[model samples]
Structures are given as C-alpha cells and as structure tokens.
Target: MTDANTTLPKTNSSPWTSRPFHRQYLMRQANNLFDFFEAPSLNPKGGFFELDDEGKALSAANSTRQVHGTTRMVHSFAIGSLIGRPGSGEMVDHGMDYIWNKHRDAKHGGYVWGLDDNGVTDGTKQAYGHAFVMLAASSAKLVGHPLADKMLADVTEVIERRFWDEKVGAVREEFANDWSQITTYRGQNSNMHLTEALMAAYEATGEKAYLTKAERIAELIIAKHAVPLGHRVAEHFDENWVLDKQYLGSEMFRPSGVTPGHALEWARLLMQLWILGDKRLSWMTDAARNLFRQAIELGWDTQHGGFFYTLDWDNKPIMREKLWWPVAEAIGAAAFLSAYDRDDYFQIWYRKLWDHAENHVIDHARGGWLSELTEDLKPTSRLFTGKPDIYHALQACLIPLYPATGSLTAAIIEAEHTVKQHH
Candidate 1:
C-alpha cells in the first residue's frame, strides 16, 4: 500500500482554503455529481429514482425510493439552486412535491419511511427520515422554492409534536403506522441528524428556537453520551435514553457498538454548532476536537488506508469492510477542524483522506463514487447496494473549501455573493 501520509497536502497548510482555483475545480466536480444524480432520463413517478453505482437509474424492481434518499437529493439540488446551478430548482420542486404528496402520511402526521411504484411500502414514521425531510425543507426554503416555506413549517410542526421529547432534550426513535404506537428505543443516530436539520433550520429562518433545540441535542450526545463512554458515540439506547452497549439491532441502521462514522459526523456537526454559537460555549471546541481525536485513533485502519464502519466498545473494529461514507465524514471532520483550529495533524488528515478517496472511493470512470470497498481496498458491496445517496460525499468535497463559520447552505450563498462582488 502507498504511504498515505507521504501524499498528503503539505502539513500545517490549508490548500483547500488558500488555493482558490483548485477549490473551484473540486467544487465543480462535486456539482457534476449533483448533475449526474439528476437522472433526467429516468421517470419520476413520485420521487427521483435511485441511481446505480454507475449513475444510471435503478430498475423499478430495485428501487424503493427511501424518504431520506429523496429528501437528500432535494437538499442537494436546493444547494445547487442556491449556488446558481440551472435546472436545480426544478429537481428540488419535484422532490418537494413527491415528499408532500406521496411520502407524507395523510392519515398519520409524519413522513413514511419508504415508497415504491405501487405506494408506501414501509409506513413507519422515523425521526431519522423526518429529520432529513426538515433538512430538505430548510434548504429548499433558502432557494425560495414555492412550497419550501410551508413545507418547512409543516415538517417542523410534525417533528416538534410527534418526535421531539422536550423532557429528555432529544427525540424518540420511531412509531408504528398511523402514529398509533411509539417504540421504547431511543437513539443517538436520529438525534445527530436532528441536530444537523435544526442547524439548517436556524440558518434558514434565523430562528433561535431551532438553535436552542440543536444545542440541547449536542450537549446530550457529545457532552453527556459520548464523553462518558470514552468519546465513542453509542448508536443504540434504551427508553430512558440510557446507553445500550450490548443491543444488537439491524445491521444497516441500529447495529450494536459504536459507529466511528457517526462519531466523526457528530464531530463535524459539533464544530458547526460551536461556530454558530457565536464564540460562546468554549467547551464545544474542546468536545469537537476530542471527538475527532477519538474517531481517528479508534476508527482509522492503520494497516489499510480508510476507516472501519463499526467498532466494539473496546474500540476494536467490528465491521472490517470499509464503507465510503465514513471516509467522507472523516474528510469533513478533518477539513473543518483544520480550518477552525489550524492544527497540523488535521491538515495532514485532510490531505491523507482526500488521497485515500482519490485512490479508492471516487469512481473516475463511473462519475459518482464506489459505495463499499473491502479491507484490501478493492471495491465491494456487502453493505451498500449502490451510490445510494450523495449527502456525505458532497459535503466532504465542499465543506473544506468554505469558511467554517456557518452552515454549508449559508456558506454557498455568501460565496456566490463574494464572487459577484469580486467581478
């Protein structure tokens, strides 16, 4: 294996921040991915069709059109539209229409989990999915989509009324169809995503309430949950929001043990939260740095070049297969930390992770990315089926290029304004 450290961007230097032309090129490549996933040829019955590994639309038999997937595409395109990419608003409109018309339960109060050609296949109302819907709506609102404001308000209401637990300062996990029964399971994963959505909400609407909710969540997860458990963010939890270290849930979503990807992801979010905190909450910076350090020390596979998907409580790699999103989140975490703190180690990680992605994850021929790779660095798909979604990969490329002071949606808007002013 090539020495990843040797190929890194010069230590202690911020190439992504200093080199404008290269940053433009990289951001364009990321935008091209949004174009690739637009999938104009594929028919959109309710939502945009899922793309295969090669960027073509998956066949109807293979497509279940997850709410999170559809909302992510909408959120991505809404960012594109905010950045002045043509045809992006149209895509955002399509996704918005689908979510409101098809994915939302007319009978129940929240969005369904998944839909197919026939109709809603999985009808469970998940906080995770609803969080994405809020994110999508927040971004859409920013770009002035006709339905975005109303959708944002509606989903925000649903989240507050149905999912949020103000008493616990976090959200409940899921509910049965018709919102008839709620589960005893509490999860950090959903709340992490909720924190992300709330940040966007606060950015879009200038609502301090959203920021308040987000801060509570970060305090619970990063300060309360992860710090007590050696900085490894626990994925599963009990009804009391107590850590459930031995709970073996679904392989894809609710697996046992700590997911390093999530820790790195939360690290990034915490930094963003800190940045949005207007320089108060000095502990946020410390906590963010600690999470990044913990994830790198525990999640990184030193023998190979990428991050492990899951880690046992002992910080040992549980799932050895290297999924693409973890590396993407790692890159974002490194980029944000490097930019904010100017740490040489983070700069090294920023370069090393991009090198790893260039060598293994990015699909040069196919145009998007390889979702899964074996420990030997060969492409594999034991976990993810295809280029399922673009949220993590897109952020990995774009966040490093922007100032870490605001949300990406707001950063791109400011960037566009700056470019106009320079001209």
Candidate 2:
C-alpha cells in the first residue's frame, strides 16, 4: 500500500484522463462489476436480490426488494447493453419486468418502497426511491426497452401529482401508500437525485418540462440553500423549506449535520446540469468548484487516507468511519472538475482518490468494493451489509471515460452516433 504521507508523482499532463489505456482499465473495472452482480442479483420470483461479499445472493427467496435497488439494477444494466456487453439486455429486461409488475402500486398511484415474494413490506412512497424509478425508466428508454416509455410516463404523472411542490420548486419527502402525506419533512438528497433523474428523462425523451423542473430543483437546492452555508449542503428541511439542523433520520441515509459525500455528488450533478443547459447557468460552475473544495478541505482525512462520512456545522468529522460511496462520489466530482477547468489540481486529486479506492475500498480478492472502512482504512460493515449496491462505484469507474458534457446515457448515445458516422 502507498504511504499515507506520500504524494503521487506529478506530471504536466494528466496521465489518465481521455487516454486509451485508462479507458481500457475503466472498461475492465466496469465489466468486473457487472460480472459480480448480474447473476446474483436476479431473484426469479420478483425483483433483484442483495449480494454478499463473495457475490452470492443473501436470500434466494422472500428477500426484501427496495425500490432504489430494483431501479438501480435496471439503470446499470441498461448502460451495459448500450456498451455492447453480452447478457446485459436480459438483466435489464428482468429488472424492468419486476419493476413494472411487482414494485408499482396498482391500487395506489405511485410506486411502493419495498416488496418481498409474499407481498408489500413497506408501502410508504418516498421521493428518494421514486427519483430512482424515473432514472431507471429513463435509462431503459435510452436502450429502447419495451416497457420504458410506459413506466416513464406513469412515474412522471405520479411525481407531478404527488411529490412536486410547485410552491417551493421541489418535491415533498414521503407519503403513505394511499397517497396521504407521511410527514411535513423535506430533503435535499431527494431533490438532488431528482435533478439527476430529470436530466436523464430529458435526455431520453427531449421533454422541456423535465429539463425545466431539473433547473428549478438545482436553483432551490444548491443556489438557494447550499450557497449560504459555505457550500455545505444541509440534509433536512421543514415543510416550508426551513433548514432543520437537528434532524436525524436513518444513519445510512439521513445522518445528522452536513454530509460531504452529498456535497461532492451535488458538485457533479451541478456540472451536468450546467452542461445540459448549454452552460447557461453561469453560477453553477463556480458553485461546483466551491462544493468540491469544501468537501476536500473538511471531509477528507489527510492522515487516514479517506473521506469521513459526516461532519458537524463547524466542519469537524462526526462519523469518522470512512465509506466507499463518498470516495466514489469524490472521484466523479474530481473527474468533472478536471475536465471542466482543465486544472492539474483536480487531476491530482482524481489520481489520489482512485489510489485510495484501489488500495482500501475495492475488494481485490472479491468481485465488489467494500462498503465501509475504519478511519485507519480497515474494512468494516457497521453501516452497510454485504455489497448491496453498484450504482456509485460503477459510475466512479465509468464516468471518467466519457466526456463531461452530459449524463452517462447521453454520453453513450453520443459516442454511438460518432462511431456510426465514422463507420
């Protein structure tokens, strides 16, 4: 392992960005991830299964299927199909079938949160999960899946009628299965992800409404809320859009105080939003830089060689355990910043972050990345069970291979068009 105090050798030119060798390395990593999850994740009875460390399903039957997990599988495999990976279309089809048949609430308007072989487990409809539903549908649509358009349109209506708050320019947090409000709580995490899905929807369908809503969300969350807090995004908010500094929900999902991982994610999302809008959002570039800088300065542990999970208002580390997703998000944010600004600073951080991931987070012996590590970079599972997600880690590998112009799907489509024209 590389020493924590040592710096990687610097070069005048970026050693990895846009280079063919690096692209091949990234492609291999992406393929290894697909190999790890593709077979084990397929639960024949309904939706997907959660995988263990050795890439085996935790439960063969009657396992809980969360909406986010189901949707993420669809989105990831759709990318695989677009990239010409064999057997990927089958996985996408399986996930799409399960999402439509099982996860969708036929009795209620929107999708349910969790399901098992028997029936619904948690019927609460959440904006966070629904955002992923839209994302899955959009990615499937990009790959021309049969049910993509139907699912996309259905989720769009549900979001508009139930979640979207026109008065505040963001979506409400949660609701019961019967379409009743579950809480007056509002959250930036949901809105940030919604911004991501809305962009994917626009790329898939070319609908101005989707793009318009995405812009509204960026303005409300990043420009209005985060800018004042020194680019540290507050997680919880009240019904009237007031900040809730004391709010604590799920340790894995909603931890108290500021989450630097989220700020890194928003940095990447804001950059994509700026690109999709033809660089019309001039302020977003600066905001993206600031967010990235804040996350690195406050969240990254210089001696421990990883990002802390959470920080207090004073920017001190609250959750000292380092997690994989934050490192993944930082790699992505670094890639975007490196491409946008053409700066060696972002490039240096990009290499450093990848080095940390390859050394600590990635299970070189196993097929997937470890979810959690102690501050000293030892693997631990206190916060996450076996490797249940590939969304963040996969993107961290693949996003750097594509141009920083738009979302991954959009970049894939553009690449395909470019190749065909040359042929």
Q: Which candidate is the best by TM-score?
A: 2
Q: Compose the digit string of candidate 2's lDDT tens values, residues 49-168.
A: 999888888887579999999999999999898889899999999999988988899998788999988899999999999999999999999999999999999999999999999988
Query: Which residue pairs in model 1 clash with each other?
Result: none
- Give per-residue lDDT, candidate 1, residue 228: 78
Number of colliding residue pairs in model 2: 0
TM-score of each: 0.95, 0.97
Expressed as tens digits, the lDDT of each residue in 1-423 for candidate 1 is: 223353344553545557877688668768767767776423457687767777777776546888898899898888778766787877888889999998988886789998888888999999999999999999998888888888889899998998889997999889888786667989988999999999999999999999999999988888888887888898888889888888988878887788988988988898889888786988888888888888888878888878888889888888888988888898888878887775566777777788889888998887787888888889888988878887888888888877787778988887878888999
Task: Please name the candidate that would achieve the greatest lDDT relative to the true structure.
Answer: 2
Alpha-carbon lDDT, every model: 0.83, 0.90
